[model samples]
Target: MAKLDLKTADVPKTREDARPPDGSAPIPIHSRARFSGWFGYVVLVLFAIISLGPIWIAVKTALSDSGTLFTSASSLLPQHPTLFNFERVIGLVNPADPRLQQTSFGKVDFYLALKNSVAFTLLAVVPQIAFSAMAAYAFARLRFYGRRVIFFLFLAATMIPSVVLFIPNFILIKDLGWLNTYQGMAAPYALMTPFAVFFLRQMFLSTPRELEESALIDGACYFTIFFRIVLPVHRSALATLSMLAAMNAWNDFFWPFLVGRDRSVQVMAVAINSFRAQQAGGTPDWSGLMACTVLGIIPVAVLLIFFGRKVVESLQYTGFR
Candidate 1:
């Protein structure tokens, strides 16, 4: 063997020795990392602006006077930035005021519509979530004959266009004499949706079976295990599903419009549309319209804001993962 020089065999190279032959200083690792971080933040900021632009415009329009909107259509900030539109939309404005007469103000039973929306959302979401969770548990945990086949069939229902089912559902609701009623409004959505079952089943499937086995050893029944063990452990999943179902129920228009058009049961969405249609001057009440839009959006926005992290965590740990 050749004589080995141990003195400098594995000595680390100096910065200068590691430099390229062109004599340019190599970029520091920290500098590159910082640049990448900044680039990512810039991209996120740009996307945020793009996503929020229309919402901001709607807010701006909602706050502006109707005439000012026409006069300064390009303005980013609302002219005079008044709450008159919001007050008018929410029925806080005096009905006899000259200002109220000029626009579609105080003509809408917005509070009633808001109440109906809340009621419909509750009716739709509570039963749907409860039934869907039970179905998901059965699909995920119970081993019965044809379970897989039934689940696959449920999955198949998702592929069917929702519009294709509407006529049949409408007929069913009408035949049940549920027209213009909260029950009719909720009929299509009050029970388990295929998607809800599928979503909860995935989470249930991912849950460790050891807990259930332990519960079984302690003489716990299926319902006991499901309610005490599984449901308690998946609170985040349940909350996420509830928020999604609530948002969907809150925003639903077409079904409610078709089956619940009476003023007593009109939802916020249909009410907003009717408000727009009832304007006197043949001109759209852009300010009132946008104000109604914002009001209708507020509850959903608040739900997302408060429970948004739970939603993300549920998706990350269960379905998406």
Candidate 2:
């Protein structure tokens, strides 16, 4: 038997000192918040107020009478609050059956614009999420040639200004004869965004690899692992992403404005502008414009409210598991 040298004796590792025998990185220590005192709360309150100020103003102005908005533009509160602007903006929207649009005040009724917005937004969001999740799974789990280089390219794409793509994208739309079409508004956004892929990739990395390995041993394939395990696990993250994409699609202006030639497929954002422009064919209706803007924000705001906590939780998902 060989005797161990005293100088070369191995020391036993405690939980804290143990390193992975496989040479993988150690799991991090995730400490609970060492939260600050009242100062923290005060700071958060101040920040919230500052953030909500513009929204509050918009809502207030939307509620205010047009005469008041014109006469007393600086007033913080609506002295004589009314829903005339909202009512006008919601023209011909039937309470019993809301799908169909009828004519009353505006060129394009609100319900039709809303349906178009939903259609466009869904087109952009659903496929983007599906493909982004797949790409993200590949990035996080699969080992393939040029993976690093390809992912680097994807990361690098996000850094380029979107404005740079506008002209080229417009030309492509023009060439494809998709200009002023709903498909045109939806097509450019249907693919995976670099950030969405990146975001979901990071979340995927956080998921337990052991789960996948176990699934594989159970004769489950990649698709099964992705759909059953990965997607269900990261639903909060997906909701946050979907909400973000939907909001962008819903509130999108420049692209919709550029491509939207008529009211047939008009989204809320473009319709609001055209509505405002037509209303202001002579003089600008500031109250109506504000009201339209406020109305446009409601769906996104409601989504945030419902999923806000989940979004916050998912932000912490990328932290230590």
Candidate 3:
């Protein structure tokens, strides 16, 4: 006799008991996921607005007419926008006229200060990059006496406040007859930046040892390996360092003011202060001042915008590896 089919008997029947009485549709997982994504985007948009609102306001104010800006209330958008303020403050309005201070446009002296800043940056950054890279290479690759001690000394320099060194630096510059000269303003502080050495040393240390070892086997010198191999691989670090150096040089006011008394040697930041004092007889031209500030910041902003990704990526890579 054939055995009874027990598996078919155990199967549940699709009768009244198996069915839900309400007959309501179940919620879709995709719909819930879509709602979460939209919520995340909304939060991001709000954060972006919060972060960018102030910068937008400043730009709007800078673009607005000076008369309207002073008389009118604060606004996200200017009622009557104009480029005259920027033109005036950036020296596009009046190319000549030494005594003719352009309240709407910036002074020619401002441009001169910009030139001085560029010169100082170039003079300082080249040597600083070279020396720092060399020091970092030696620290990372070479086996030398007192290496740890020397590196520690360099690291210790970071703890010392820059203000404490100002007086001594002034005395040295005075003795060298470099006061009021570009050398006095840029040189003393340029090479002594321990941060550069430290940063570059870390980058060098993070490089694969086998690459350098291979280069050595191929009869390449340390400098050859560094210049030919390491530098190319770490272009991001170089870009970041260059941008930092340039920004520091351009924005340096206190040291330049102390060392460079001569109007000819004054940098843009120093010149802007002098302009404010001279222009504001009783009331400061907030519009013009803001305009100049905006102009002065453009180069740095542009640099960062273009190279910021590289800077961030390099830092992240250095940190991780």
Candidates' lDDT values, in order? 0.82, 0.76, 0.73
Greater TM-score among 2 and 3 belongs to 3
TM-score for each predicted model, relative to the true structure: 0.83, 0.73, 0.76
Model 3 accuracy (lDDT, Cα) = 0.73
Give the lowest summed-lDDT range of ten residues in model 1: 1-10
Residue pair clashes in candidate 3: 88-105, 88-106, 89-105, 89-106
Report the lDDT tens digits of candidate 1 across residue range 152-198.
Answer: 99999988887789899999999999999999999778888887898
Candidate number of the best TM-score:
1
Clashing pairs in 1: none
Model 2, 151-171: lDDT tens digits are 999989977787788889989
What TM-score does candidate 1 reach? Answer: 0.83
Q: What is the lDDT, from 0 to 100, of the residue 291 in candidate 2?
A: 82
Runs with alpha carbons beyond 4 Å of true place in candidate 2: 1-50, 71-76, 93-108, 279-282, 311-321
